[model samples]
Target: FMDNSKNMDIDYKKARTFLDAGLTYPTGLGLGLKIKVNGNYAVNLKFNGKADLNAIMNNPRNAHFAFQFVPSGSLELASTLAVDADVVESGVKVSANLHSSTGTDLTVKVLDGYGVDVKLGLPVKKQEILNFHSDVFSVIREKTGSEVETPVKFNVKREDHGGCFDQLNTLTGLTVCGEVSVPLDGFKVLSPAYGPSKASLRIEKEDESLTAYHFRAFYDNKQPDKLSLEVLLDTPNSKTDRKFLLTAKGSMKPQKQLLIVMESPLTVPTTFEAVVIDTELEQAIAAKLTSDTAAYFIKIGAHISGDINRRKYEPILEYKFPETAALSDKGWIGRKGVKGGRQQQQSAVGISGAIYVEKNPGTAYRQYELQSVTLNTPNIKVTVDGTITIDANLIATDLKASYEKDTLTLNSKIQKLGERKYIARVDILPSKYP
Candidate 1:
């Protein structure tokens, strides 16, 4: 018997750590600091970290409003600043990061009106190294092809970590001090998310070092489907030393594809545990890549057999080495034509493979064999070279075709490819002589 109990699960530890901490809703922490800069610009400061209270914000022009830099192992200061001007339609936004041990970090971003943006880095300066990035997609609207009538729908975009685990809410727009009616020098100041009575930044001795840890996702608010848990633990006697973070995520897609994936953020040595059970197929795969070249995968698939009483099972164990696994290569690239050039024509090549098997209730089983290799582009033609098996006979084919006018025109040998398989099967089937 397999010792499944001995498995090292980070999810178990993460759940206990998060639930014990509890959730805190975003509060409009009363009146903060507001200052006027120039004829067209103004600044607002909000300090929400565990730091000393300062009502008078002097020289509050973006980063200038921050508390004087403090030495390590002292007061924990969590603060942010914002600036606005009539120029560029909106002024640039700058944030003042205050840490308990280290000085402060300043990150500036422009307001491009992209609707959504995700900024990486913890509220505490020390906890920036183990910055967690999770895979959670928010709703985004965009028109696909010109032919399509409406915009494309929202989807859970799967991005293979090129790099963040916690989804950072895009940098917030300008927030004016609510309580006091302090007007900007020139441009109109936009309203904050809360009313004037609320404080912009509430100062408490116990500030959250985890910064942006708690997150909730709901399709219709019945219940949450994704859970992101992260814990940032910093050791004492540290100024230059960076803090560490432990992160793990769990997601359930009950409506689509019936998927449950639990991930442990291991950027250097990648690993994942996932189970996919849907109407058409069922598979459970666990993969771990300890090093660049050494990787292992264990998978099990379930299939219903012809006989209802019997079930078929497929157990697969695969190991990938540095030599055999050939990674995909960068394909050919060249300018097709330029305005004053002689219709510069260039062609390049690449390689790809696929294995697809399909079956219809009681019909012949058809499996799409992997094509030897081909390159596909808008103005390029290619050949299909792959052997397919239909019930009993095996067909070898080399078919060529060109695609134009949004149609694929087959122009090759033997009528030219699939007919050979049907003709061969006809000779074997019994003929009716009248």
Candidate 2:
């Protein structure tokens, strides 16, 4: 008899024992013994030879015991029980399967097996793992030509502690570094006019408190028919508004160049400048520069082609004012006068008609014969029809100026005496239709 009690009361005389011996007591004898505790016992055995046992003894208090066993090449037994007791509260509880394990799995839980389940040794397939090289190469081939064989090298590191905030005590950080190549020829299908080029991209964080960053993208090409473009983005002082800048330059043909620059700021208006130059002609054929609050100026300059006489007689020309002028309801206005006096005059006058230029016989000076030109000032609603001749510094005209319901005919000769000084002789006929 085996007992763990300090006191025992039993009658040996009343005890009985029985046994049976088989196989004539010579060949074989079989014996079996079974014992059970009075508390709670749970045993789960599977056909694959895995065993799970959970037992709770009710002596003195609740005591838990559990274990799991799996028969495999790597034999391992795992405990599936956890005991928590509080002496001050005098609380007792029994929990089963608080932890479990098998040949390829181990799981643990707390708080009566309903909280914080942590699992380990979970099965994973090969396909579930990421293939870095293959994926990167596939993307590169898709962007570039399929014949590309560039090697991609990268590394990944896991940091145990990265960043933290309130209520979050642990953080994991993953850092990746790599490089990818992009062929410029791949984009030819999108824009055939662009020459062979290479592009570079850069990005940088400017501030930690604000969402401000600096970005730049540049594209460059070879010489002769060269092209280049750059873009920039930033915040001026980590406090001001964001700003963006773009500049583009291209030289397509001989002696021809193009330049463009644009700037945009969140607090102020945008500004831009564009120019197209022909170095052979030593001029810009078309140019523009302006801002939102500034005066806009545009000029188009070109050389007149064809017969010399026709070029001189029927020339097309453009003119630009030296000073910036403001556009108003009454047309462009010049600078304001001093002390509120008369406003300075401003005009953009264009003239086109048949005109002749001839050299005076035995004289170094030339004469200009204006055959027919009609000048009109739409803002003032006045029209002038004139035939004039300019010889040396003298201009002689016989012209008619017509206004609303009035026409005046004048025959005049004006001679320039000095800068801003002129002497004139005029004969004005009475108003014809006043």
Top candidate, metric TM-score: 2
Candidates in order have lDDT scores of 0.28, 0.38
lDDT of 1 by residue, 334-353 (tens): 12367433232332322233
lDDT tens digits, residue span 1-434, model 2: 12312222322211112222222112122321211112222223222111122222222122222222231111111111111121111111111111121222333322232122222321211111111111122111222234233322334321122221222111101122222222234544233122211221211122333322345555667566878676765533445445567777877676455666677654344344444555332233544444555545444443332343323343233333336454344322323457534332334554344444555565545545554443435444455565566676788877776677687787888898999999999988858633
Give per-model CA RMSD.
Answer: 30.1, 33.5
Candidate number with greatest lDDT:
2
Candidate 1 — which residues are off by over 4 angstroms? 1-223, 235-239, 254-273, 278-280, 290-294, 321-434
Residue 351, model 2: Cα distance from true site in angstroms: 7.5
TM-scores, one per candidate: 0.22, 0.28
TM-score of 2: 0.28
